[model samples]
Target chain A: MDTLINIPTMAELSAKGEQPDILFWVGCAGSYDERAQRITRAFAKILKHVGIKFAVLGTEEACTGDPAKRAGNEFLFQMQAMGNIEVLNGYAIKKIVTACPHCFNTIKNEYPVLGGHYEVIHHTQLIADLIAEGKLVAEGGAFKGKKISFHDPCYLGRGNGVYEAPRKALEQLDADLVELKRCKSNGLCCGAGGAQMFKEPEPGKKDVNVERMEDVLEAKADIVAVGCPFCMTMMNDGVKHVEKEQEITVLDIAEITARANGLL
Target chain B: MLAQIVFTLVFIVAVALFTVQVRKIIRNIRLGKNICRNDRKAERWTTMARVAMGQSKMMVRPVAGLMHLFVYLGFVIINLEVLEIVLDGIFGTHRLFAFMGGFYSFLIGSFEILALLVLLGVLVFLARRLVVRLKRFSGVEMKAWPKSDAIYILLIEVLLMTAFLTMNAADYQLQSRLYGHYIQAGAFPVSQFLSPLLPSSTEALVFIERFCWWFHIIGILAFLNYLPISKHFHILLAFPNTWYSNLNPKGHFSNMQSVSNEVKAMLDPSFTPPPADPDAKFGAKDVVDLNWVQLMNAYTCTECGRCTSVCPANITGKLLSPRKIMMDTRDRLEELGKAKDKNGASYHDGKALLDDYISREEIWACTTCNACVEACPVNIDPLSIILDLRRYAVMEESNVPNSLSAMFANVENNAAPWKYAPADRLNWAQGDWSKE
Candidate 1:
């Protein structure tokens, strides 16, 4: 089973022995963000299928306090971060892996202030690794036959500079990709973030997801694939209201990859 | 005499109302707490001079910029004519500086030429709004009673200028008032050449000048005082707001302070606990709910619509509009300010973070992308406010999206916002690292 946190101090890490090959850190987004769990499960299953021996983490993990801090509760975030670091210290974990882009960014970028420092990579990079190793061969050239679109989650592409990894992973999966007009640095918000998933958006002239879905529809793709869980929920909700029975499906990169590997 | 007295009283009343209205609008924005507050005094002044005063924002579009420039410059130049009327009222002389005929005539001619240019400029602005309807230029266009008031104010100024020029050449007596001046000495060239045919007396010209002058100055002053309530309030307050605008590092996140600064607190790995800080501050949830500076920004918007134009979420047709953000802040601040004054306390219970003023989705929908600020000519950073609100949602309320919760957990445990840990943190860098 994967652990929930990262070991920030070297003393705790040294006590346990040399840090494990990877400290598997499962974030709040992954555990509770419905699509994230499905995507993460697919990524794990795919890696396992291809003979990769990665440790599982965060089958039981607490929130990182990003939402608390963002919502103006800095004190809570600090408490949560400290508690999470203790969980990692017990295992002497130094290196880490994450499926959530926001988690990847926060741990890689934020936890250093809390005395947590470790190498972290998104699952997309791991998939890129799997592709590079030639351990798993792609089965179908037919996968690229139809057009597909990718949504860039803010934390993944802009916050962490991991723009190309996911796209490369998609290319490896042989997806015939179409892109929204605003991608990469100018990505659209899916309207499901910053605790927006917990509460309804204020009623206004339009829903942010509805606006973003219009872009996917404008791109005219057969399937809309996203890397982030929030993007999946928002795009799904947006399409549900606007294009019922429209035959367009929303899938995460991991799920898509799992399908490509004939594991789905 | 009775007619003049009645008109004077009417003009005074109009100006008073205009002044009252303008004050009210500004007061409302200050009271709402939607402004960005930080150590930004220098930014406020510099941006006000560079962006607002220089009309740098208007220049983003060439044609609109040019038209606005004319109106702005014309309004200043027209002030000379207004001063001339004030003097005539006191001295009872139709001629502006009649003692210096040569200079007075030249000044009059120059002002007339400038007024004509202003008319032409105003025409372009009207056409853009009504005829061209440029996408970038479009906004929540004011209409109905407000529109009528706006038109009424503009028309009065235009008519006074037109009539002044006509009386100069077309009015026989006023034409003689210029006497022998060097610049365009011939009255026939201007419309007032025929003024001698009407009432060729000094008293008649004086009477006419006062009539036109009152219509122009009184109308504008009246409008000015009433501006607080009117949509045109931006003209008065945009300067101070722009001058004090945040000029700090763009997209700079507040340094996250540590409440539990102990690294050893987590070494044993057995506990998951919330903070025991009984008096800890959570995220910003309302007005008076914000620090002084974020509240100040609500007061400074020029309403030039630049933020909305650059907003990616807005361009995508999201309900989030930056322009509306400022407007709603102004609206709510006014509401709260009144209550604060009335009750000696803030009306909201620390959660003034109202959906009615600024929608919750609009607040969270922002990706901390900084596009709105980058596009703002006045340099109002909307991203900071968005992040501040996010902090409140996550920390105080403990109501965050599952996505962020996942991110928080991953970063805390594995140093990544992911559920499934990668066996290798840098899987792509592995081969490169070994070779290096």
Candidate 2:
């Protein structure tokens, strides 16, 4: 594994009077959260191994204001949105790929009206497309015959109707892809959306993550794959809650692809 | 002549009262703020055709969908017989459409078959509610009136279909006996089974037929008027509601133009801001603040609880029930409409939808995952109302939960939801992934 991966920032690319093919939007969770960072790295490794030119916004990127918008603070959401739009438009960025469904959803659907229009896609979508093109060959070296189930993220699945892309990426692993009963459009939430990640769940019999984890457990998969950073956190917590961290693994789709393709 | 006069008077009064109630409902819906749902005309029509007219969304649960389709098709097709009934009631003629001969018999045969299907469907629906007690039907919002309203509609439909079949059975027997004005112009495929049960005397058959005819017509009229007040209103409103559905991607929550303008003015000193309306409120506090499409959605809800049942929060025992949000909005709107009717338009009951009807706990408990919106058979958007109510709590009243307050502050200051510094955002990249 490459310990010192050379990642270019948009600022450096702009100073060189050059532009990459895509701007990697390392969302706040992917940037700061310890677990999600592995996903960010795995996805970056895949992009690099496939020779796809991409640049990160580095410190210049801000939250896509999804949480704030969901929390009902339109003012704060717009402020963050406008700030990010200014930076994105300044870079003349045309296409973006992110590992966070919240960022993917916000920039793809919500930013056009604020004068920030660009083609935004989730990392799983990019991985799926790359696999379709035969750019990243999946040998399923480590994950061969493993039972894996993909958890649908709210913003990515029901919110935007991109259910097939993540599944397609996972399909490349050549693993026994088990499905949770509540998958696809009917998938359950991880209790972290709409800014619920920032607050305690108002009195409930079971945490939303625990309820969702029950579906994962019933599916009896060895590894539960996820597409979004928030799902990563919630599903990981759920695995820990059930003390199945040793038996059941929670891996992001990109991480699985990275391992299966021998990229990491 | 006396029977014609009495029937016409009852029909006129029923229609007039129905018109009055429908107009009031339209007025209540119009009380909401205007929105431009007219942009995608072609797509809107297609959606209406597929969802409402075609009953596509109802088919998500095949059994319920098929049953609903049976009842719906029966109600619409059988109502054609009502046209003949109205003409006969007015002109005092018997079986006026009998002039069409065999074609008329074919039509009545189809109506009889459809009426039987409707009866069977209604009984199953009643059993689902009362006997099976589906968890969706027993939601907290389904208490009292909502629960009973569903049962009443099914029972009424049962009665109407039964009366229709009995009227046909009595008429068939009378026609067989060649009684006065009982022409052999109709077919009774399903009701033929009932023909043997009628009395053999011609006079008794005439009395039974005439009494059933009168009962069926009056029941239909009463059912028509009851629609504007009951959840049965979905029968009429579903078409328009599906037509006005949000055609954009489901993830898209509309940008508040009012907030965008204010933010632009704050950021760019050179930008000239439009003059603000003094009456502008930040978000929805009551029904009037919501868009007319949302208000129509409230009226279109059939209290199916499909939304609440699928809600992740509700499933996990959180207070957020999307169906309840719609119910509360409709209930509050009805209350306001009544108050306005009694005392001029300015009347305020001082009870708003936010804290009074839908509590902060309920709205805050929402994950805004759009599950409810997706599950709605009629495309009702309870999430929009929940978001708008949350906006009222956050912007208008600054009454957010303590946890979200910190998140709001952090987003405003740190550019992220957490307390992490902006510079540390790139630190994740510098880590030694080889160690793992």
Candidate achieving the largest lDDT: 2
How high is each candidate's TM-score? 0.58, 0.99
DockQ of each two-chain model: 0.12, 0.77
Worst-scoring 10-residue span by lDDT in model 2 chain B: B427-436
For A1-264, candidate 1 gives per-residue lDDT tens digits of 223222223334445564545655556556555555666567656755775445644333556655554444466566766666666656656787777765676667667767777788887787778777876555445466767888987777755556787787777656678888778755766765554554455445677778877788889877887887777878898889786437688888777777777766
Backbone clash tally (model 2):
0
Taking the tens digit of each residue's C-alpha lDDT, what string does model 2 give over A1-264? Answer: 467777899999999999999999999999889889899988988888899999999989998999999989999999999999999999999999999999999999999999999999999899899989999776677888999988999999999999999888887677898999898888998889999999999998999999998888898989999998888889989989999988999899888888877766
TM-score winner among the candidates? Answer: 2
Among these predicted structures, which one has the highest DockQ? 2
TM-score, cand. 2: 0.99
Supply fnat for every model shown: 0.20, 0.83
Once fitted onto the true fold, the runs of candidate 1 whose alpha carbons sit more than 4 angstroms away are A1-264, B1-45, B87-110, B132-173, B177-208, B254-281, B291-296, B338-353, B381-389, B400-402, B405-414, B422-436
True-structure RMSD, every candidate: 9.6, 1.2
lDDT of 2 by residue, B66-139 (tens): 99999999988988999999989988998899989999999999999999999989999998988898899887
Cand. 1 TM to true fold: 0.58
State the lDDT at B98 in candidate 1. Answer: 54
